[model samples]
Target chain A: MNTFFTIVAGFLLVNIAAGLVRVYLGPTPADRMLSAQLFGTTGVAILLLLSQALSTPALVDAALVLGLLAAVAVVAFVMRVPQSEREADEE
Target chain B: MSFAGLVLDGLLALSLPVLAWRALSARDLYRAVILFITFGVILALAWARLGAPDIALAEAAIGAGITGALLLNTVGGLSRKNDKDDERPDEPTDRVGRPWRTRLAVTVPVTILAGGLAWAVLSFPAPVVDMPSLVGEAVAEGEVSHPVTAVLLDYRSYDTFLEIGVLLLAALCVWSLGLSAVRSTAPEAVSGSPVLAGFVRLLAPAMVVSGVYLLWAGTSQPGGAFQAGAVLGALGVVMVLTGLLVPSLGRGGVVRAGLALGFAVFLLVGVVSMLATGGFLAYPEGFEYGLILAIEFFLTFSIALTLTALFTTVPPREKGGGA
Candidate 1:
């Protein structure tokens, strides 16, 4: 059980590391921005898994906070960074 | 720990330095900032692995989330201003022109100093005193149920007091160097995005609820004023960037008062308590919990206001940079 959760979390981290390649080669800045979106989802998943594995409910609250604030960077990216190689004004 | 757990911890430990190196060594500023955000996310996980959930929340919110937004905002502004040069991959954001010998000259002594510090830390002995147990007993006597809360508020409140003061001072410094006007307009702002604005409006409630929950949870759990404040401040940044807020608003009396409220309330409480207890920030025998909660409450507001003000640092509107 705990071991299962830990491994899952570790794989998620590895998943993020794998996603780093896309960040480098994603051409447009908007495509690069998806890395942050990946982090928000994967980071919350990791935190939630760790909370269950470690039996510390505090980490759930951390996950909640992470889930809530996850889109902030995306919003900032959309609102601030003007579309350079545009697909749809801010693609 | 099991082998799987060990592997997970190992991945976290190894990746931190690797990610940091990548962020620093990246040629493009945008990539560097993006990598830095990724590093912050992993850093929060590391803190959680160390069983520090409070720091984890703060790091996730402030270090990873809001800081990423702020950095991205700066990157956006820089890219907008310098359209020609930065877009090119060949032009590095910064070029280290120093010769290899000069770099080696600085690197050698710094590496030795870092090694010496690491060695000293590794060799350090366990404490003669059992500080955790002592704190446990003291926390039992205090109003706050949580050990971290007790230490932060009842046991060593002066640090929290001075921290709020420093926050105020930081806001002051940023205000003095007014920088709000130059990059106020955004493509989204000019071409109105009601969808984003509606999304933000929807987010406001969740942020307020979570922030209050963090502050309230601090009495018994890992959530605290700093974490709560950070959530609110991030909300502030979102609103400010959306043009729902005037960039020059931080200079207004209402916002300044909100900024000062935390420090003022804290000092007033401290002075009142000191007059009775003969020590600043000392609470009455049974009134400790209430005092700590009140202080935490105000500190949250002050911190939130200060952080938002720092983010909203445009040149004063009167001399507005023609935005």
Candidate 2:
């Protein structure tokens, strides 16, 4: 059972690494920002799996913190992105 | 170790350096910052894998969440400055005047040093010394149930005391910089956006609950004041960004008191303990847990306020001024 969890976590981590390709080849800042959001969600999943795999329930707390605060960076990005660039993208 | 676990560890080890290289080499500052955040999350995973959930929690909260926000804010400021100077908007500023040889000269020793450190780490003897037994014995007489908290707040509390001092000093330094004038012209969140306002309303309470939960759980679990404080600090950032909480609130008497509450309480407790127990920061025998809890509560409040203040670049508004 623990091995199952570890394997799943490994696959999820690969997915996260794959998402980095978008960050690397981003045509716009928004794409890169989205990749970060993806990372947050994926990271939470990995933490959860590892918690079960390692039989240390305390790791769930780390996952909880990650989930609660993950949207913060996105909020900062949206608020700080230039008005002209935002408008250009929207149009 | 199982084959699957080994593969997972291998992938994590491999991705760390690759992700770091990609982040550092990214041409766009924004992309670089984004990649850096991802790197932080990955690093947090590594910490978890190493069985240090306490560090994992801190890394996730402060390293990824707060640091990412700070970097994004900085990137925004940099891009705006570039616009003022009519520089290219998408690309980061070009390297100025430093020759490739000079850069390589710096990189070679750093890389060798990093490799040497990694080699040392990997070669550490099997069966790492178990400190849990020692910590358990020490904490059994202390107030806190959690081993990390016991070590941090009791056994080696002077370090924690100095840490609070460092945070306060950092806040002082930021305050000394004087407020950025561009703050007045900064873009405000659109007030008409119901979606955003509703989201903030929903999320704010959840963050508060989680922060408090982390603080309370610290006595027995992996959560603690620093992690909880960071979550609350992130909450403050969200509120400020959404314009629900004005930056000037940071300067208010109540907020200022909250900012000083942790250090002041800690010092007062230490002094009182010294007078009563003949040792600084030594909790009275029967009141150990209560004192630790009291100190942690105030510490969380002050740390949250300090972080929020540091993150906000604008100066406080004058009384009676409308947003």
Candidate 3:
């Protein structure tokens, strides 16, 4: 069952690669943005899986920091964008 | 190597690259961002499975949290003026074809590197000198019982100090990018989403409790101030993002103080110890828990604040460009 989940999670990493392609090929900036986020989320999943499999305590810290940093990045980016641009770019 | 763990791991492994691919392939950036955040959460879970709690915490906090915020900000900025240019390519002919050379360049190297790494990680036996064990023994011998925490804040305090500096440096780099010029309207604020606000309200107290639990529990288990503080900081981030809490330059003295508090207290305690006991970071014998708790609390606050600030961009004031 754990291996199953690991496999599932591992598959998700491929999705991340797809997301990366989207990021590069995305028609709009929003698309690229979405792709980047997808990568971040998937990266987290990988860490979670590794933590359990490896049973090494250090990885937990890495995961926690990753989550925290991801949150901060989103907040800061949202805050920095101009209102007018946000309005215009909502598509 | 249990059947269950193997299957779960396989599933996770399978899903990751797909999500990455879809994230990059998606037409809308918002979808990608959401996907990425979800990916981060999953990664945390994976870390837990691997038995590396510290790395898990860092991955969740830094990899998922901070990276997501930064990407979103960049997207927002680009959407404003560059939308038209960024939208569909300007190919004169039919659909644009992905460059084969680019594909080969990316694929060949990644395949080789990943294969080599996977094989290496799988084949390597556990090293004889396990630092965690040595650290654990040291902690047991010393007043600090938690090896990880001791490694982070005591035995290896220097690393902790430098890591904090790295965090500051990252914040400075982001600040240098001129994010402050953007107005703080907080269009992404939680006020727009009733459900989100409600969720935040519900989660606030629980998060606080968990943060505390993680801190105190670190002495015996896989919890500590850094993990707890990051979690608590996350709560703050959530509130700020949702508009439940507004940030301002005027009265952030408390926040500023919190930002500076941890390292300050640590350094002060270190200096004081040197003056009193003739060594650095040496808790004055019997006052171990007291000093450790004090430093932990301050560090927690500072970490929370610094993390928050790192996400909150400020415009530079009259400094020469590109310093």
TM-score for each model: 0.91, 0.88, 0.66
Listed in order, the DockQ scores are: 0.63, 0.62, 0.32
Please name the candidate that would achieve the greatest lDDT relative to the true structure. Answer: 2
DockQ of 2: 0.62
lDDT of 2 by residue, A25-56 (tens): 77677888888999999999999999999998
> For model 1, what is the alpha-carbon lDDT of residue A15?
93
lDDT pick, better of 2 and 3: 2
Q: Which residue pairs does candidate 1 place in steric collision?
A: B179-B313, B179-B314, B179-B315, B180-B313, B180-B314, B180-B315, B181-B314, B181-B315
Highest TM-score model number: 1
- Lowest summed lDDT across 10 adjacent residues in model 3 chain B is found at B314-323
Ranking by DockQ: 1, 2, 3
Write the residue-wise lDDT of candidate 1 on B24-84 in tens digits.
8886667777888889889999988889898888889887888888787766555433333
How close is candidate 1 at the interface, in terms of C-alpha RMSD after superposing the true interface residues? Answer: 1.7
Q: Model 3, retained fraction of real contacts? A: 0.61
Question: What is the two-chain DockQ of model 1?
Answer: 0.63
In Å, residue B253's CA in model 1 sits off its true spot by: 1.9
Give model 1's docking category: medium
- Please provide, for model 3 over B22-124, each residue's C-alpha lDDT reduced to its tens digit, 9 standing for 90 to 100: 5566555555665666566666665566666765675576556655664564455443343354654322222456688977998899999999999999999
Evaluate candidate 2 and give its CAPRI docking class based on DockQ.
medium
Docking class of 3: acceptable
